[model samples]
Target: MSTQPPRLPPPAPEDAAARNMRLLVLLRWLAVGGQLATILIVHYGLDIRLPIAPMIVVLAALVMLNVMTWLGHPHWPVTNFQLFGTLACDVVALSVQLYLSGGASNPFVSLYLLQVVMGAVLLHAWSSWALVGLTSLALGLVAWLSPPLALPPWFATTLSPVYVIGLWCNFVLAAVLLVLFVTRIAANLRSRDAHLAAMRQRAAEEDHIVRMGLLASGAAHELGTPLSSISVLLGDWKGEAAIRADPRLAAEVDEMQAEVMRCKTIVSGILFAAGEVTGEAPERTTLRRFLGGIVAAWPGQVTFEDRLGEDRGIVADRALAQALTNLFDNAAEAGASAILLTAKLEETMLVLTVADDGSGFPAAVLAALGRPYNTSKDRRGAGLGLFLATNVLRTLGGTVQARNRPEGGAETILRLPLVSLALEGSR
Candidate 1:
């Protein structure tokens, strides 16, 4: 037997800001490319007189910032501070480009709102408000300081129709990119949140199981001494000459002894099942002998049938025997006169089935067979048997399933994959 603590579930993940930062970085590159194209098209194709050298310098600075950002991406998580700074830098860069071109008169001025909207969606309220302030300051500074861009040579003498067309293009581009990117990022955020929520729920369930296991272990320890004393008293009564003279009294004493032993068995089983104590070290034994021992110990008539061609040797322990005993006990308690205990080899797995000739399990009981405090019995503290049995098998990488038989009674199937059991035994 191996003593081990209850396994805790893995921790829930943090927010999905890292991927968001990567997306923002990629979008920045596209913005840069778009800015360069627009600059070239207006200056060369449209024959507009502009300060090309200064505009190129600002674009170069933006590229270098993006490169540094991309390089540092994998090193740190994207926090609120990082996102705020990134968006602030974007605002500043866009402002500078707008200033170099046409200040507040630039058609791309609405692009500022894109950053504001994204900040509201992806960042804290304070950070989003901070971005709004920074953009407002940038707009004010650009309006007050920068010179307006000149129109094309042909339209220099009149207000240009091309400027109106540029405004329409900027509106369309901003709307399309915002819709596409924001929708995708929102979906990613939703998925990340859903995963984290599931992890949290699983963690809660694991915690509940751990608490129950600890409580069961504590109860077992508390009951040990009292059970031992009762066993001693029963043994003394059995040995009494006067009591032994009466055959009926002797049989009753024998029954009491058996009941006491069952109590002791249950105490040890609980502790072992909880992994609080390693009751006994595993021993090498044949499947037949293992199954035979459990069947012999059962209080009711349990018929054992081995369908395997040949019994194979494996590591066996008290926990495995106790679990099988629990199944048998459950059948007997359910008014079963006889239980058919069968063992067989199915491919690389060992299959054990316990079928009873009692009334079948209720739908509710069958549905929640192995869950703690979920049982058909009215006895107080009676449900832990199947629960402990299920957990014990699970620790050995096996599974237990219960269902009602169509003809009558209930059937429990326990399967242990040979490969996993071998691996466990090796460990």
Candidate 2:
């Protein structure tokens, strides 16, 4: 049994894109800071003569772009193309800044590699490769057209100790940024993959439920004829003179008739749940009355607690009712003599909890609670009750969770939106 905690549903593609965009915006702000620091240190601290005016204008434009992106990101739909465009803008800004300083001679020219790496991770394949081409072209153009930097005599040559130190500093900055942003991007991709896997698992479970429902419906239809025949035979026997004269025989006939009627009821429920029978309208009742009815029908020692201060009208869902009944049955089968059921309204949700003094579920069963045939019971077809119940709740956009209580017993919780069962016009 795996003890992994439950995971929240995956975010939509747009949500993921929005998050990635925010990451880009943050990276841009960091770039702005790093560029400002390097420009100041070189122009003032190192006594290098740089074209400060035009470079400041480019830095200002980059700042404005970051501001606009941060403000407008949530208003528009985010997409791969949008991500590609954002990265392209960053590349353009970087190239312009480099052209102003020393073009390709600036050790910071290596920073173009950082943009390419980001594109590879965040953009579509074609866009990624296009960014590669764009960066390569920008580098060549800057090298060809820009004026040479007015460096000190000691730093004039590329192999000078001062030039070597500048290159080393640029390498360290690029390496740190890469480690920070790339890891975050990788984490986002992993999250998206996990969500996709969860969706696939849910699709598979739903398919399995459909197949089982069809089989159960067909079985019910076949059993209808034999059950009807037996009911008619018992009716005749009850009316016969010999059986009527013997009170004991008549009593036994009555018991048999009751048993047959119970079996017929079970078959009808199966058909109804499968949508094979839909002529009758759904029953409508109050929440309190509906739960009370279930408890009254169960032939066991059960306690009901209604923490819902006010009752709301609801369309009685027989499937939901049966699902709760299955929980009770499981409790009894697990050697529980007494069960406690509680109902309450939490915000817009309806919550029901069942706690029992039964031997709690085995660790393996708890680990694979909703998966079909994942049961501790040794008998054939013993696990379908919980499986069917779990699926029923899932169909209603609810979930069922079970765990062993530390005090010695098991607890199962069911939660669903109240709107799923609320009566029309009864808010």
Best by lDDT: 2
Q: What residue pairs are clashing in model 2? A: none
Whose TM-score is greatest here? 2
lDDT per residue as tens, model 2, 1-427 = 8898999899765677798999999999999998899889999999998888988888899899999999999899889998999988988988898888877678788888888788767776667767777777776677667677778998884444465456545544554465457656777888999999999998998898889889989998999999999999999999999999999999999999988997887787788889876466778899999999888777677899999998999998878888888899999999998899999999999999999999989998988889888888889978877787788888888999999999988999999988999988875
Q: Relative to the true structure, how large is the alpha-carbon lDDT of every model?
A: 0.78, 0.85
Tell me the tens digit of each residue's lDDT in model 1 across 1-427. 9999999999766457887788888989999999999999989998886788988888898889889999997777779789888888899889888888777567688888788778867776667667766766676676667675778666554325576456545544554455456656867888999999977864664676789778878988989989889888989998999998999999998988888888887778678767665447645676688789788877668899889777666666567787888788888888898799999899888899999988877888778766777876788978776776777677677888988898899899998876544435443
TM-score, per-candidate, Cα-based: 0.50, 0.62
Minimum summed lDDT over a 10-residue window in model 1 is located at: 418-427
